[model samples]
Structure formats: C-alpha cells, structure tokens
Target: MPRRAGAPEVNAGSMADIAFLLLIFFLVTTTIETDAGLDRMLPPIEPPEEDVIIKQKNIFQVLINKNGQLLADDNIIGLKELRVKAMDFLDNNGDGTCTYCKGKKDAESSDNPTKAIISLKNDRETKYGTYITVQNEIVGAYNDLRNREAQRLYGQDFTDMEATYLNPETPSGVRDELKEKVKRIQDLFPQKFSEAETSTSN
Candidate 1:
C-alpha cells in the first residue's frame, strides 16, 4: 500500500517578518499631513486698564457672519477684493508721512502703516476656513507692501530676505544685515491686527 506523503508545511515566520519590514518602511517614509493654523502671539492680560483710543481712520473694520459673509468697513465684499482693500487702507498715507506709499492718500483711510489696524471681528458660528482666508488676505497685503519697499531700497524682496534670516544656517553677520533691512521694510509697512470680541451684523 502506497502511503500518501503529507503536504509540506509552509513557514509563516518569514511572511510576518516581511510584513513588519514593510510597516517599518512605511512608518519611516510616509509623509503626514497637518492643518495650518494662525501664527499669532497673544498680548499679555491687562487688568481693567483704561480703553485706548484708536483713531477711527486708523481702524479698518472687517467682519464675518455665521453664513461666511465678509463685510469690510460695514460693506459686504468678496474675498478677491479684500487684499486690495486692505492694502489701500494700510498705505493711505493720510498724514502725508509715508513717502513711499502709493495710495491715493484718502483722508478717511489710515494715517500710516504704523498706525494702520485691521479690526477683525467674526461671529462665533463663522466658518473657520472663511476666517483663515480673511486673515491671509490681510497679511498678504502687508507682505506685498513690505516686498515692494524692500525691492525699492535693497533691490531684493523682503519675503525672501526674511526667509534667509530665519534659516538656521545663515551667518550671524549676514543675519544682522538682513535684520536691519527687514526692520526698515517693516517700519514702512508694519502688520497689525486686532481680534476684538465685537458684535457683527448678520
């Protein structure tokens, strides 16, 4: 009688090892996505301080309602126009001080970039994406002004100079020069935002 040979036993140890190696490879090489958030520093808490008076012309009010509607200075507006509006408000040179400003020097607009303030107020139920977009537009306007100033004075873009200044490998002496240049540009077009808890109209 011919006895049937038992089937060869397959080893699963190597298969498990391969799977573990694959998992490790993915863990080491896989890129993870993260949500971008606001990079703002909060002011120190002041105890019952007197209200500081900000000139009405210096304040550029922006509001967002629960329905993601944007209002700039109480007028309903689209996101596409927000950057231009912000730039105009910041560079108005109403006081005739910002010689580099290209604005129309509207008497109702901001006195100077140093005094320009964007008063951002949003309803509690406003979409986070809408708020971020608005913030970006405002910051972009400032960056544009700074870049133009840097280009005119230093023959380079302020944003690029700033990126180099922030790099870890930059030399201290070079960083110092960049710092002065950045300060000059910033002095011309400073970025200021006020996130006050003011009521917004729907």
Candidate 2:
C-alpha cells in the first residue's frame, strides 16, 4: 500500500492473480447458453433466370411495417389469421392440379402449393418478434399441409419423417423409404419463401 500526495493507493501486488483466478472460475463454471430451436435447414439457392416470369396470382405478398403491422395479400390482417390465410393461398388448387388439396379453388389466389411463392417483405425497423412470428406462421402453414399429405400417404407425420431422415442411426432400408416419402411430400408442398430486402426508407 502507498499514499500519493492527495490519493491513497491500495496494494495491487496480487490483483492480477486474483483477476486471473476469477477469469478462470468464470470460464470453467459458467454455462454458456446456446441458441436452440427447430432444425431449419434451408434449401440451396438457385438464381432465377432473367427471362423467367412469375404470374401475379402465384406470388402471395406478406408485408410487415415498422409498427409490426402485417399486410397479407394486400389486406391488413392479424397474426392469428395469417396461417389460415397462407394455407388457403398455398392449397388453392385453382388449376385443379393438386388432387389432395382441400382448399377452395380461388382463381384470384395462388395456383397450387408447388407454384405458390410466399413473398415476405419487412421494414428495416420491424420488430424481431414480429418477423419471427410471421415466419413461424408462414412455415406452419406449409408444415400443416405437408402433415396432412403425409398422413394420407404414409400414415405418419411429416415432422416425424423429417426427424427420422435427419437421424444418422436410422436403418438404411427404412431411411431409403422415408427419403422417397419426404421427397414426395416436399414436392407436393415445396416452400418457396422469397424474402425481399428490407425497405430502405423505414
């Protein structure tokens, strides 16, 4: 310990060692929390061809503003209604293509689940919670439809099929069967989520 002209200084001899020990304690004892959630593995991205044209009816627009307000299909709607709305749009069966689809054949809505593209646009200031909720709702719509189809085709849940496919210890024969089922289910309800860039003005 030492005292300067107008300041008293405590002993700093073992301060470094104490700090080091504290650091080691935190490193050893502290449990770091890792973010865990659903296994969301996005498919590979394929750049669109220049001449490709998307019909206006096939693109379902979902807009989120800075205030977390949702505008789906050009109509201001609540989060509770988003999933059902999306499901209807996805399974519209307008062209009578999807034999399993039970949705109303709304010609103004999407053509089919395969060609239905969910266009999501959010403002820069949109709340993270709003964004996540919207995402979950949209994804839930697809999952619900796929589950229905899986149940009809394989008498199993699509989520379980996906989990089994992802598991490494699954038997090869069963995995192969599940692979075909999964692929067929996915082809029936291919999730085409197109997230537009955030609005710069927001």
Highest TM-score: give the candidate number: 2
lDDT of each: 0.88, 0.91
Flag regions of model 2 displaced more than 4 Å. Answer: 1-19, 36-50, 169-173
Q: What is candidate 2's CA lDDT for residue 130?
A: 88
Candidate 1 stretches with Cα past 4 Å from truth are 1-26, 47-51, 198-202
Residues 1-202, candidate 1, lDDT per residue (tens digit)?
A: 9998999999787998999999999999999999676789898887557887789989999988898888899899999999999999998999998788888889988998899999899998888888888888988988998998888998988889999998999999999988888888888877788897846555
What lDDT does candidate 1 reach at residue 130? 87
Pairs in steric clash, model 1: none
> TM-score per candidate, in order?
0.81, 0.83
Best by lDDT: 2
